[model samples]
Target: MSYEKRPDGRNFDELRPIEAKVGVIKNAVGSASFKIGKTWALAAVYGPRELHPKFLQDPAKGRLRCNYNMMPFSGTGDRIRPGGNRRAKEISMVTEKSLMPVLDLKNYPNTVVDVFIELPQTDAGSRCAGICAASMALADAGFVMKDLVSAVAVGRVDDKIVVDLDYQEEAYEDGPVADIPIAMLPRTKEVTLLQMDGEISKEQMAEALELAKKSVDEIYEFQKKALKEKYTGEQNE
Candidate 1:
């Protein structure tokens, strides 16, 4: 298959090497560790427990909240400060939203399911990775859901559409690189999360969506495989 040339010497349609595993944390209900090239993200799921402050609890459905963070040494740059900043807060919100639609919250009732995501390594598609890892962790946690959400980043570079851009590739252009992150429920083909940093023509947007869908398909497979590996082992014992 013909592919667009990329600065990282990868085909435009190709994703960086990805490896993921679930249940890395023994005590946590669910946990996952994932890496895309050098960038990595870890996620852990806790509770479906009582909601703090009580008033925030919804009696009819459970709550899903995400806390996304970047470790100071995650980036190649100098030691970064730890704690929430504007960027971290925004990403946490989006990441939470991306995974919300797929959860069958009503059954949970008055409890909150907290998903904590950390980017131990910074890269262009960290948010997408966070979503993917969180989903895996949730599945490992044994929640009822329509489907595990799959995510990927789509970018326009040198007039070519690319999947899974790295840090340098994401910073390639000044204008809208069309840095878009999308999350989808593969079975229903429903979009759970979408964010665009730059604008593109209608045609490019269509191409981007198509590209994202295909990329998500691959991601979903990995997620499923990771979950199966975890539960299958437990069943054997």
Candidate 2:
């Protein structure tokens, strides 16, 4: 028996509801939290300060490091062990690449800009959510950026392409499948990060790209609202 799809009958181009909150952690230099459906991510940015070790320093530019980790209870069944793993490392590396283009690294010189993303829920498209949260945190940190980066994921399941896969959809797929995660600078329409997993035909890839672009636009609006609220509170003081 086949399971019924979700309500709203959203088309391939539609995105799940998104919510963003800024300054969630007062102690961090900057912090932001966001959720897309059941998937949630929180990001914190720290420092344009001195590098940790002599060997790690870069004379030409500041270093930007990212750490992406999933909470033990993020998934439904088994829990993940805390610390670096292959998947976590890959996500962190991708996140670092995504933000490097937007940041004004030269301005910071030998300093380091560190970003940490924590996923407290497991669902499809969490990587994209991580990127979105990290970008917002960086913005809250008052770092100069060319434009805000927004991200989204698109995938195919049950012969129907979809935007923002949920946890179950990602797990039990059959036949050819595709998952594309993208990070783009919304204002400039520049792509800083792109990753695809599984196999997809060229036509399907094109369709997914279109859907991701639309999703990113929606996410950008949500992020802007959260940032405005954070700044407004500061102004009122």
Candidate 1: which stretches are off by over 4 Å?
Answer: 1-4, 174-176, 233-237
Write model 2 residue lDDT over 1-237, tens digit each, in one string. Answer: 333463446565678788899888788899999899888999999898899887898989899999999999997778988889999999999999998899888877788988989999967788889999999999999998888899988877656678887666667445555677889988776888888877777787787777777778888999999999876775233
Instruction: Please provide, for model 1 over 71-165, each residue's C-alpha lDDT reduced to its tens digit, 9 standing for 90 to 100.
Output: 99998778869999999999999988888887888988999999999888977789989999999999889898778988999978757888898
Worst 10-residue lDDT window, candidate 2: 1-10
Whole-model lDDT, model 2: 0.84
- Model 2 vs. true fold: TM: 0.92
lDDT of 2 at 131: 91
Query: How accurate locally, in lDDT, is each candidate?
Result: 0.86, 0.84
TM-score to true structure, per model: 0.93, 0.92
Please give the distance, in angstroms, between residue 159's alpha carbon in candidate 1 and its true position after superposition. 0.8
